[model samples]
Target chain A: MIRHSLREALLSLWRNRFMNLVASFTIAVSLLVLGLFLLLAHNLRSVVAAVGSQVTVSVYLRGDATEEQRDRLMDSLRGRAEIEGTEYLSPQAALEKFQRLFPTMREVAGELEENPLPASVEIRIAEGHRDPDSLRQLAEEMKRLPGVDDADFDLPWVTRLRDMVAMARAAGVSLGGVVGLAAILTIASVIRMTIYARQQEIEIMRLVGATRTYIAAPFLLESSLLGILGGVLSLGALYAIHRHLAASQGGLVPVLRDLLTTSFLPRSTSTLLLLLGLAAGALGGLLSLRKISL
Target chain B: MVELYHVNKDYGRGNHALVDVNMAIEKGDFVFLTGASGAGKTTLLRLLFREEIATSGKILVDGMNVSTLSAFRVPTLRRRLGIVFQDFKLLSRRTVFENVAMVMEVTGVPRRQQRVKTYTVLEMLGLNHRVRSYPLELSGGEQQRVAIARALVNEPALLLADEPTGNLDPNLSWDIMTLFKTINIRGTTVLVATHDKDLITRMGKKVLTLDCGRLITH
Candidate 1:
């Protein structure tokens, strides 16, 4: 019975070509826009995490501060709980690291006959406490410590990047939600029209002893197929667009490359797109059930 | 194999379609229901087929209560009966063979057997060469024959037809009657609703006449 119904549904899809095309167009467009938004959101989130993880505070110690004072500062930093972890970089390690960054400056550093770099406590703050206000408060508290000479961070730029990421997320969700609903309505309307065209056939089927389940099965099958097909088309389009952008080699390319190593949709995200497309189609079919059985 | 006891059908505003209608049809009997327009011939047939429930009554066809049948079971009851309409109601998009073989499809008959049985039935109805023709391409008489073929393809125990010849010419109508006679001879109970008094008298079958939703004679 299911086989026959499936055959009938496939036939219906072919017979109602124009209506099916209309439905597929709407679904594809809707899913494509939603996919693009999610893809951008994924990249944005990666950037935010990358920036968030880079926030580290180095507290420079005074040249004359006692060992007890250093111990007291280290213990206070550990007890604050805002710190993820800390590493003590002595004057020698700091000089070596600076030389590693600028290899040509090694002779200049040796000519000084003394390490000019300060012995500092490098603090990796917890992700949640890395906001501008909290970091400022932490830096102020650190400057008052007995062994601390200075505490500083690039707060202006980091604060701007965080605010921008939050705004982009809100905008993506709002725009994607509105368009997705419109696409679902389009699918439902198209299915409704196709079913209406076959009203006479359904009535005749009933007269010939067809159960209601048999009569309604074909419509459901057709709608679900349309949905999944639309999803595939959307994914294909997104891939093509991503490829185009990747090939351009413009100012955006380096930043995009730095943030995202692969194309827009990762394996997991593409799977989610497929499942979402299927759900939209199923929901549209369900909405039109009462009309078809009429 | 059908029984109706005190069946009444009301169509809102106190318009009764069938009132206190009691009747019985024995197995293998040929029965005719006659009345003028709006006298409830269609409604009575509708009730027997479970298309509509009676306001107050009991209807048993083939040992199942029609009035109490669930929505899904309506198809099961219909599977054991054949019904033809004046409009033919044949699917215009499908070929004669597809339309005729659809009953077997509903019963889950294998594909090979469906073809064989459909071919045999169409050939018996003198529609062998027209098997590939669509319903719109066939003549009125031929269309009516295809409808009959579809109804009988399942070899049901009973057949109910509402004005099966109302759209055909006089000669075609007589031919259809002969076809029904041959079916009745093969031991299937047949019930037809029509108002052609001349044809009714000539056939001399069991006639049930209705007047104003009331059964006047049997």
Candidate 2:
């Protein structure tokens, strides 16, 4: 009998080809938009995190500071708990790197025979001190050192970048929340229509002594199948869209293929979609049955 | 067996569909519930099938208080009762064979037994040749016959048929009633709700008469 009910459901769906098409298409489109936002949020988060890891504060040497004074200043900065490690870029080493990076800069360097480039210490802060307020306080402490000419910390840009990342995150979360709500509502509406279309049939089934579960099982299976199929198709669509965008803009969005890339809906997420579809269908069934007597 | 103790089914404050109706039928007995339009004939049948709970008092079917049966247990109660509706209620998309087989299938009869029983019942009803025909393809009388076949396929302990012959010719009505009589003789208690006084009087079964939702005579 269960098989018969399933067969009946599928056959009916097949017979109503137009309705089935409409329902599936609505589900697919809603999921696609949702997937697109999810992919965007995932890639943006990766890029921001990568950029945040690479920024460091550079503190230049004092004019009267000797080599020993510079060494002491470096040690003092390194001794601080927030400073991870320090790299000393002497004037000569800085000039050599510039010469190698831009051969044309060698002639420019020779013109300034004294090698005007200042000896700077590149201070790498522990990740815990990556926040703007902490970096500013650390730079102030280092500026008080004996040999430090003036501490030059790219503090403002770091703060701006953090704010931008935060804004992106908020935007992503908000977009996801809105689209997810729309997707769920779309599923609910379509399932409701499906139930309404079969209201008469359900009434007859109840009158004929079918149990609540018996009357509801087939509809639940039908809606869940649609949702699972939509979720899978959304995963594939998101991946395809991600691949297309990555090929077009790989330079800007290098993290397009990160851990959270649009691939198959994670097993847990797809399972959730399936359950949500079933729940939507079950809710419709229950509402339709509320006043009906068996 | 069936018993209704002061069965009062009121739809609302002022509208009474059945009022203080008391009745009883013994095991293995056949009865006709007779009344005119708005006479609560269908209401009485609905009460027996547990389709509508009585507003007050109790209805017992086969020693079970049908009025107290929960929605979950209604199907179990219905499994022992066969009901033939006036409109046949055959699924329009299904063939006659499927319509008959559904009843047995719902009752959890094994597939092989369902096939055997359905075919035998169809053959008995002279519908073997039309088993593959959909309800829409069959005549009114033939559809009613299929409905009867479905109702009897499970060999229900009690049969409640509502206007079984309303859509049939006199000859077909007699034929269908004769089939009901045979099934009743085989120990299936039958209660038929109908307005055809001529047919009920001719059949001479114990008739319970109703007027304005009250038992007028018996």
TM-score of each predicted structure versus truth: 0.84, 0.81
Give the DockQ (C-alpha) for candidate 1. Answer: 0.59
- lDDT tens readout by residue for model 2, B102-133: 76666667999989999999998899999999
Candidate that scores best on lDDT: 1
Q: What is the lDDT of residue A217 in candidate 1?
A: 77
Best by DockQ: 1
lDDT of 1 by residue, B88-168 (tens): 999998999999898888778899999998999898889999999999999999999999999999888999999999998
Per-residue lDDT of A176 in model 1? 55
Sorted into a CAPRI-style docking class, model 1 comes out as medium
Candidate 1 per-residue lDDT, tens place, A158-238, comes to 777667666655665566557667777877887788777888887777887988778777778888888888889888998
Second chain TM-score, each model: 0.98, 0.97
